[model samples]
Structures are given as structure tokens and as C-alpha cells.
Target: MLKITDLHVQLEEEDKKILKGVNLTVETGKVHAIMGPNGSGKSTLSYVLSGREGYEVTQGSAELDGEEILEMDPEERAAAGLFLAFQYPVEIPGVGNMTFLRTAVNAQRKARGQEEMSATDFLKEVRAKAKSLKIDADMLKRPVNVGFSGGEKKRNEILQMAMLEPRMCILDETDSGLDVDAMKLVADGVNALRDEGRSFLVITHYQRLLDHIKPDVVHIMADGRIIKTGGPELALEVENNGYADLLEGTA
Candidate 1:
């Protein structure tokens, strides 16, 4: 559902390039895992795809289901069915989790010219989703990730994804700081969202998460480019041998 071609991205203020000629395509109903070491531009690819500020696209193009998304704003990208689950979920001290989720859900609906969800209906739906994600009701009543633990934050991100139901989801380090139980919770939530029309691009360093998600394709990215692409076995190979072999000539 997403195609990126010869993508080149650089910081606007500093002329440092982050992604160089990166090409990738994620089809509907499949999960793609991007594994790379630190500073490999994995996160840069995510930010560029989401239309975040300061990343200048010096070259290439990104299309979401045949429509170019390189020039679209962040909100427009979201409204067009692109969702990014951040590596580090920010804390909103004053905003309750339920309130924030409702606002986001209704905002997307409004952008899509759909009727707004009433408070009662929204609560019922969100509560069921949160339960499936193992997020307690009390947690939803607290400020959005304000005082939550790392696992809590990740679970919250998945909960948001479950609520949004975007066509393509980019999960950046969604398993960064979670225990085994928490990881299973997040993975189950991700699997539940998978279907014939939905796709996922999971960016991570370890193979443990891949064991649960079972990606359809695995890509090795290094030094701002994807140098290798294979099946789920590629993730296991990387985990066993590290990125040394792939980074040698590529870097």
C-alpha cells in the first residue's frame, strides 16, 4: 500500500543527508520488518514518510496507494491512512488518555467527512480495545503517558493504533522497553489489527519482536539505505550475526 522510490532526505538547517536512495514497497496484507543498527536512518525514513518538519526531501518520492505523499502535511498523511507509532511517546500532562484518544479519533473522522462518535459510543468501543490491549481503565483515566512506565507507553501507542485503524502503520521501535509480557500484549494487539487491506512496517533492532509478529519480508538498512531484503530468516541471521556483515561495504 506504500511505495518509496530513490528517496533522499537531509536536514534542512544542516546539509547532512540521512536517507540515500532508499527504495521500498509495502503491499497490503503484509508486514515488513526493517532492522538496522544505530544511525542507520531507520527513524529518519519514518519521519520523512510522516512529513515531519526539518527533514528536507532532496530527492525521490513516496506514494500511498498511488497518491504522492511527499508534499502532504503530517495531518494530511494521517487522514490519508498513514499512522506512525513513535519510538518515544511524548507525555501530555494536562490531557487525559481517553480524552486525547477521543479527540484524535473524532478529528480523523471529521477529516474524512464522517459523523463524530458520541461520548458513550466512543467510550464503549475504546474500552473494549483497551481491554484487548491489556490497558486498564484506570490507566486511560490518567494523563496521556505522563507518569506511565515504558511498557505502559508502548501499550498506549498500540491502543491508539487499534483505535485509529489506519491502512498502513509504521511502528518505530515499539518494543524498545518492554518486558516479555508487555511485548506479547503489544504483539497481540498488532496481530489483531492485521487483515487483507492493512499493512505494517515494523522498525526494530532485535529479532524477539519479529518472532511474535512474523514479518512477511525483512530488510536490512544501514548508513541511510536498505542494502538487503529477505524473508523472516533474515531477522534471525541479523540477530545471530549482528549488522557487521551488512554494514561493512554499505557504510
Candidate 2:
């Protein structure tokens, strides 16, 4: 479960505020979707929660399973079961995909005081997860996201999520740049991992992705604040009317 209360964030080098009082809770075993227009701070909230630099938390706090994560380093947060699947997955050239993944998996295990998985176990696990996400062997042999298509990158992100098995997953627009088939494939991978012990916070601009991923709750965010909360129908409303009607007095 993730709990965010009155969270206010501002860019470190400027006077502009990005998240002004973002209070939301993602209960365990549930999927929560946040829909908003451009510059609404949806992505900013994801970065801030994952401990990305350049943004200062001016007020409030974010907690994962009742533990404060604001003070933890990025890797420390990962060790504590927090994962962010970026909208644009970065490319790390000259590093084999398997090598990068094994290092990350073992590093987190070391940080959590768990034994490192042997090469055989990791190989078995990664191959299974990659297959589920439709990641072929050739793709895994290449550098991370080096020549991957948009859908491949997103699927790779899901594969990371599956391999890590984080309790709270923040998917920052996993549907971005994905066509219908790719989106459905990605959603299937996400849905396969849903369980009573894991939760998801999906940030998106449209409802097509929600159609595939059926969120339990939907929130309308505008001007750095979550202004409205409702059920899955809320996403339908946004698709029907857009954010203009919802933004009438939210400014």
C-alpha cells in the first residue's frame, strides 16, 4: 500500500511548483489510475515518489507500507519494494540485458539481506518473465532498450517489474507510444502479476489502456492536485468529455 498526504513539490532550480497538495492512497491489491491533461504533474508525482533528483518535496510525505520513503535513497526505496516504470526507458549501451538485470536483482537482494540468486535460478526466472512479456532471446541479448521499439521498451519494463516483484508499482504511462496490440500485450503482462499483495498506480491520459487494465479507482488530476476521485466510470467520463469540463473550478 502507498499513502501520499498533502504532497507539495517544486522544481529545485525554479520558483514553480509542480505538485500542490497531492493526497492519494493506493490500497494493497488494488489498481488506481490517474488521468490528466498536459502539465498536470502526473509524471512529476511518479518521479518524486521514486526519489528522482531536481525536485524538492516542499511539504507532506509519501509512505510505503507505513514506512517513510522520502529519506531513502533511490536504491534503498527499491529495496523497500518501490518500482517506477518510466514512460521513456533509458538505453544503456554496451551492457548485456541479462547482465544488467542480474546485477540489479542481486544488488537489491544484498540490500535486503537476502541471499543472491545463483546464475541458474536467475536465468530460469528471467527467461520465464521475458517470455511472458513476449521478449525474445535476441532482444535480451542486446543492450537494454538499445534498439528496442516502444512496445519492446515498455514490455521490458514490465519484465523488470515481474522479475523484481515489487509490492507497489508506479507505471508512468506504460501505454504511451504503444499501439492497440502492444498495449494489450503489456496490459496482459501487468494483469498476470496482479495479486492480493501487490498494488498498481497507473498514470495515463486516455481510457484505452484502462479498458485493458480495469483499474479499481480513477482520479482526475489538474494543476498539480488530485481534484476528483471516483470509480472506473471516472475514466469513461474523461474519455467522453475530456479534462476541460473537469477543470472548470479546479484551477
Candidate maximizing TM-score: 2
lDDT of 1 by residue, 7-85 (tens): 9999999989999999999999999999999999999999999988999999999999999999998988999999999
- The C-alpha RMSD in Å for every predicted model, in order, reads 1.0, 0.8
Counted clashes in each candidate structure: 0, 0
- TM-score, one value per model: 0.98, 0.99
Residue by residue across 94-141, what tens digits does model 2's lDDT show?
A: 998889899989999999999999999999999999998889999989
**Which stretches in model 1 have alpha-carbon errors above 4 Å?**
249-251
Check candidate 1 and list the clashing pairs: none
